[model samples]
Target: MTALRALLLTVAVTASLSACNRRDREPAADAPLPAAEAPAEITPADAAAPMNFATTSPYAAVKLTLPNALKAQTDLHARLYADEVRLLRQFVEGAQADRSEAGDDPSIPPYEKTITLTAAAETGKLVSLRRDMSEYSGGAHPNTTARGVLWDKALKQVIGSGQLFRRGADMSLLDQALCAAVNTARARRVPGAPPLTLAGGGEWTCPRAAATPFVLAPGTVDGKAGGLTFLIDPYKVGPYAEGSYAVTVPLTTFRTLLAGAYADEFAGQPAN
Candidate 1:
């Protein structure tokens, strides 16, 4: 099966925007010391101007079957995929099944349900349809906090705008092979694996030993803006494996951001 990529891979940071307002016609400062001006009358929703979602450039989507495996070979591999999914389901199902005898459950177990998208990826879109989404760990994100605010705004921009929202994942930690596609993906390695040699006269080096010694083939993507660093050795985690995942942008968000991003904040104003 094709590895599910570009699925629910989202990362975020704090951002904001500023709007200009017109000055109210008033008399001299001395004359203004009279009755305090009443607070600007608040506008009701029905009376407020409509917001244009089209200008926004974010598309909401959920990554299905991520942080989960599909198949396994050995018992060890089984633990990596199927077994893990089962145990996770057990936790989500909770003690309801334990109080009843087999085939007598008033409520059926959840593991058998077909919903597969993680809560993080499915956020801000059609939610009631994916009833089983409650079980996703990432889905139960807390609101009323700073991260929650950013998530909501960012997600709104993404879904409402229908723009391409690319999630960056650091796979250099998972599979060194991906380094072939994104040179920035370099991770530690195991012995007897490929070594990260300084290739093409680049100053890059393998952080750890490879399965075998090899050159650190540093390269660039054609007409792309980011650097690609390759990792050679395969690192192992006890009874499992791990790697880095990152999101990469492709001009769209960056261009959209130029209007309000870190560098664009000073735009539409005087040269100070």
Candidate 2:
């Protein structure tokens, strides 16, 4: 998804009002980074297991696409994907109603909307699910945002940051590390871009202990534990133009902060 896709989820209803001053939708100058590196396909062993879902939707006009590994598994994840599809359809229907109520104008073009949810990473008992939405409904530009879910199969639950990290650990250090990685990534992606600081200034503000948002990144090598991947939404750290930022804090950096079975998985030998 592009930067514009970052705003789509929130703008579903207000697109009609914003469309009045809309400019021609331009392609994003930079592409949003992928949440993680995905395996080309589900392995033969995983594929041997049966998985099934209604791929096409008559109500939402949406399709449920899942990674082969995720599809092959018959578990809570399958139901999660189904629920995602249902929510997406609701968003689309809401957006369409807004458009209809706003009335038509020759100057305003038809809306083109897309919502996609994908599994960014699946290793052992953990899976990362990412949702990307992009919609253009008579606005100066489209809106987009990518959201993620960390699913723990053994626990049979969605893992939150608080549960993942040990209590009394230094969250400030985690915040600092995330900002540094974001600064480095920004400089590389935009040559000569001004650097960001911990303070609220420049491209974005750093997230604090209470508001650190993150997703899991795929390891540099397949099936390895890459560690926690931070998600910096537009306006959360920077202007909407910066889109969303994803910074991975390697497992090695804060192994001590991890807790429970997931922590054991993070500390274990890298998967080959």
Candidate 3:
């Protein structure tokens, strides 16, 4: 009887030990699950691939190309994408409405909107980009527009034209310099056209350097900024027939106007 009791006690102890082992191996019902793996980071190589979107139907056609340089920065890329998508949606809606009202007019041309962003210069942490957008919805011709984007790599955001200069800096000097450059370019394009005056008169009035869109242009030396290139779309300083004008103002022309933070980023003469 004593041997039988000892045997029973041993069996109970063994079962208890096994139960404890099982409890240690299995997770508690209330315990949190393992975390999911994080998404891969975007590298320069991944950003090199441009983001392109295109679609066409009987109603309309849309095409957009965002350069890889713009994609390198996370926030900038998201902002640009959202803006482009919004514009694209508006165009699509307009096309749908036009088609509905026109009642299957086969002769009507399909509406179009093409937008492209190109890297103008990349020096240090500054990236200058030019955006050209063309849209046509049964007009005399497709209207084209140009804009400049100055992106700061370190900040991961866009730097406005006003931010590049000192607080309340007298831009009159820069304006005069840009006006002179525009006249030079105008002479080459339209030999007999009247020069643009800063006095703001008629169609030939010179655009203010502060109000115009401009990008940093490449310098003669590699990896350096030469100057600012003002992007003047058609009908700005001249008639639409003259097309667009890209007047470059060398660093020497507007060096003193630069903010203290941006003084070191510019050097050399314009490569063009």
Candidate 4:
């Protein structure tokens, strides 16, 4: 019954690379451009990729579960699947190497990495995957990290913050929004719960940087594409006892600053 902590993990931006591209255009002075439009049809399938079975290693140390749609016959999907395999393999090999080196150290117990799919859904044209990964090496505690994977099925490439956002956007405002969300969540905690303290029990606090940690939550026609959910690890924004916090902001709050398919798909959709 380990607590799931949302870590600021990194996922490679190789899937659906081409789909995030935008065509160049110049508008005339005093001329109004056409308003953005949502897709003609907005079916559940249109919003997300198909489901898939889970995969694991014979050693029972490494496991991988992904969308069935991600394992399609297309080259892009193949590459995506391969990438997943490679990442799991790395964890397996690293663990094995650690065990080999720990032969004389009775205090170090061998452990394996378990990657479980916790959430999978679609937002606009993007398919998002959230995984809870845990591995115990020779340390005081096991390493558990919450990770995110964002893919563009149309472009057959994975994406990251850069692909999801436009240039020259007001990043500081976005950071402030995240801080406010986290503080608000903290306020809702049960009475007497451990409070989230500053980094040093002083004025030091979470920074309003461009690379604020976050994960994309599921989005439906009813809910639409709200602002991306910001994820802060237990010790990152507060004490370890405070655990982790995830807070959501409305897309309308920063819609004008977004770009690419993420922006286009939610252009005309109402936020919740």
- What CA RMSD would you report for each candidate? 24.7, 8.8, 24.2, 13.6
User: Between prediction 1 and prediction 3, which has the larger lDDT?
Assistant: 3
Task: Give the higher-TM-score candidate: 1 or 2.
Answer: 2
On the 0 to 100 scale, the lDDT of residue 224 in model 1 is 21
Residue 195 of model 3: what lDDT? 85
Q: lDDT tens string, model 1, 1-272?
A: 00101111111111110001101111011000111222222234312322111111111111113222111112212212232243333333332232222343345322211223212111122111100121111112211100000111232211111111123422233233333323433322233333344232333333321221111111132212221122222121111132322212222223332212222111121111
Better of 2 and 3 by TM-score: 3
- Candidate 3: regions farther than 4 A off: 1-50
Which segments of candidate 1 are over 4 A away from where they belong? 1-95, 98-162, 165-239, 247-272
Candidate 2 has a TM-score of 0.69
Please name the candidate that would achieve the greatest TM-score relative to the true structure.
3
Off by over 4 Å in 2: 1-64, 201-203, 209-212, 220-223, 234-241, 267-272
Residue 24 displacement in candidate 1 (angstroms): 66
RMSD of 2: 8.8
Candidate 3 residue 59 Cα shift, in angstroms, is 1.6
What are the per-model numbers of colliding residue pairs?
29, 14, 0, 9
Residue-wise C-alpha lDDT for candidate 3, range 1-272, written one tens digit per residue: 12212211121211111212322121111101112233224446444434876778887788878888866666566555544554565566667676666674788777777878888998887888787777666645666767777777786656766668888888998899999999999998889778889997766789899878788999997888899999887778876677888999999988888888877788999999
Write one digit per residue (lDDT tens) for candidate 4, span 92-193. 554455445445244533445555554445654676656555544433444455545565667645565666778777776676666667667776763443
Residue range with the least summed lDDT across 10 consecutive positions in model 1: 142-151
Please report how far candidate 1 places residue 101 from its true position, in Å: 5.8
Residue 124 lDDT (model 2): 79
TM-score-sorted candidate list, best first:
3, 2, 4, 1
Considering lDDT, where higher is better, how would the candidates rank from best to worst?
3, 2, 4, 1
